[model samples]
Target: MTGTLVLAGTPIGDPSDAPPRLAAELTAADIVAAEDTRRLRRLTQALGVAPGGRVVSYFEGNEAARTPELAEALAGGARVVLVTDAGMPSVSDPGYRLVAAAVQHGVRVTAVPGPSAVLTALAVSGLPVDRFCFEGFLPRKPGERRGRLREAAEERRTLVYFEAPHRLEATLTAMAEVFGAEREAAVCRELTKTYEQVRRGPLAELAEWAAEGVRGEITVVVRGAEPPAAGEADAAELARRVAEREAAGQARKEAIAEVARGAGVPKREAFDAVVAAKNAGPRG
Candidate 1:
């Protein structure tokens, strides 16, 4: 029988945040795969646990070359523990390759849950937290990133993102353009660590703050758009929205009401949308 694979989460900042299970796993495992061996040493020292196992580097550069070797160890019934620099493994970090290979080989996989910057930032973001999606990292190239941002402009659930300090300003600027300047957002830096800061404001303001320079890991949370104001939409714009929905297969009346809800306009005024559509015909 193949041995089980354990994916342990490391502390994002405060060493005290390290869970007891992490230390137990480290000492119990037959081998430990870490993103940074030096950091792993520091972590074990912090946890005050004697690692009774072999330590190996399993970062991005060597992930491909090391996957097969690690799988072989597991096949030999060796308990393997995987750790990243911070947070849970495979969450925008190393460990995914091993997990995938383990699954392919029918190896048991488990995790020691620990602190997460994504959850921490979202909790304190003051935005809607009922539903959310994590966008691990955006494209470094401006055009590709902007295109992706545009697609999520109207997403109702709050959005979470990770970005390098160098690109935070540019990414925030693109978010302002796509989601609108007035959209609410929070920039969380060095979460749960010294110099931790959470800047809450409109996306445009956040963009300006990022321009001044930022350091440490960052998690950005942005509120969904409030939708366009239907009272401010005018007749033509209302017709356009209704027509667009109808083009997508909604009945004319239903489409108008839905558009009204989205635009924050009264349903009565939205009724005019159907009439406008008739007058304009199917041209536009």
Candidate 2:
């Protein structure tokens, strides 16, 4: 019989938040795969639980290469516990590949629920959490980042992202450019840790603030695009929105769909609007 694979959530900031089952699983596993073996040691020490299993490093650098090995251990009926530096595994962290491999190997997979930076930031963001999406990290390059933001410009669901401190200002600037300066957002820094700060304001204001240099694990929550009021989104407006998206690097088809969604109109209506605009355009 295939062994079980446990994906445990570690503390993001306060070690005391570690789930009660996490310590027990860590102690009982036959093999422990940790994103950072050193951090794992510190965590275990804090919890006062010595692993009865062998611990191995399984970070982004080695995750692809190490997943197969861990899968084999699971196949051999060795109960494996996977933990990242913080939060849940496979959540913008290093556990997805291993979990996929375990499933392929017919191993039973389970999770130890704990704190999540994504959910935590969203809860405190003051933005609508009824519907939200986690965007993880954005591209490092300016153009790529802008393009990604543009793609989500018309999204009506609140968006969440993890960003580096050094790049926060630039990211906020890009968000303001793509999603509008007045779009509301919250920059959650060092969540659940001492000096935890949640700076809430418009994207442009947040960008200006981040310019002064901020630090810590950052989570950004941006309010979604507001839909136009009933009878407010005219054909010209829909066409204009689509054109803006196209200028920002989105394909015409996707741009139309996005604009339609934001305007609460049918894709066919948006497409017709675009067609009419093109037909009425000035000829060279």
Candidate 3:
């Protein structure tokens, strides 16, 4: 009979946050796969529970080569447990490859709930949580990062992102440039840790604060763009937005329709606006 594969969540910061089920699984699993063997040892030491079976390293460097081996163990009736250095496995961490291999081999898969920095940061960000997206991390390269931010400029859902401490200032600066200086945002630092802090304000303000140097694990939450005030969107503004969309590779008709919907104006009005703008000579 095929065995089960358990993906367990570890504490993001505080070791005390480790769930009871985590310790139970650690002691019961027949094969434990950890992102970092030494860190896993530290976690088990803190929990005061030693694994009853073999432990193996599974991380970015060896995941590709090790997943199949772990999957075979699962297929052979071994209760294999997967855990990362922090939070849930497979969340911008190692575990996806092994999970995929297990699924392909008909092995049952499950999970143990635990703390998450993403949700923890979002809850305290002072931004809308009704609808939000977790953008794990931005591109490290400046050009790629700016392009990604530009693509999400008009996103209506609150945006969440994981970033390194050293890059926080640059990332915030890019966000300020692309998402608007006055866009509301929150910077969550070292969540669930002793020095945990949440800084809430406009993008430009956060950028300035980060510029002066910030530390610890960082998660940034930015408020979605608000629709223009009613009657405040004139034909020229509508035409300009549509043109911007068109320049970004959207069809002219679709861009006009999008602008119309965004501004709550009729499509005919938007079309007329574009035509008028075109005939009124080049905009200054």
Clashes of each: 1, 0, 0
TM-score of each: 0.82, 0.92, 0.87
Q: Which residue pairs in candidate 2 have backbone atoms (N, alpha carbon, C) closer than 3 angstroms, thus clashing?
A: none
lDDT (10s digit) by residue, model 3, range 45-137:
999999879999999999999988888899999999999989999998998888889899998999999999889988998889999888889
**Candidate 1 has what TM-score?**
0.82
What's the CA RMSD of model 1 in angstroms? 6.2
In model 2, where do residues sit more than 4 Å from their true spots? 246-254, 264-268, 271-284
Better of 2 and 3 by lDDT: 2
**What lDDT does candidate 2 reach at residue 249?**
70
Residue range with the least summed lDDT across 10 consecutive positions in model 1: 241-250
Q: In model 2, where is the ten-residue run with the lowest total lDDT?
A: 241-250
Local distance difference test scores for all models: 0.87, 0.92, 0.89
lDDT of 1 at 228: 61
Candidate number that wins on lDDT, 1 or 2:
2
lDDT tens readout by residue for model 2, 201-263: 999999999999998999999998887878879889898888877776778998888788777
Judging by lDDT against the true structure, name the best candidate: 2
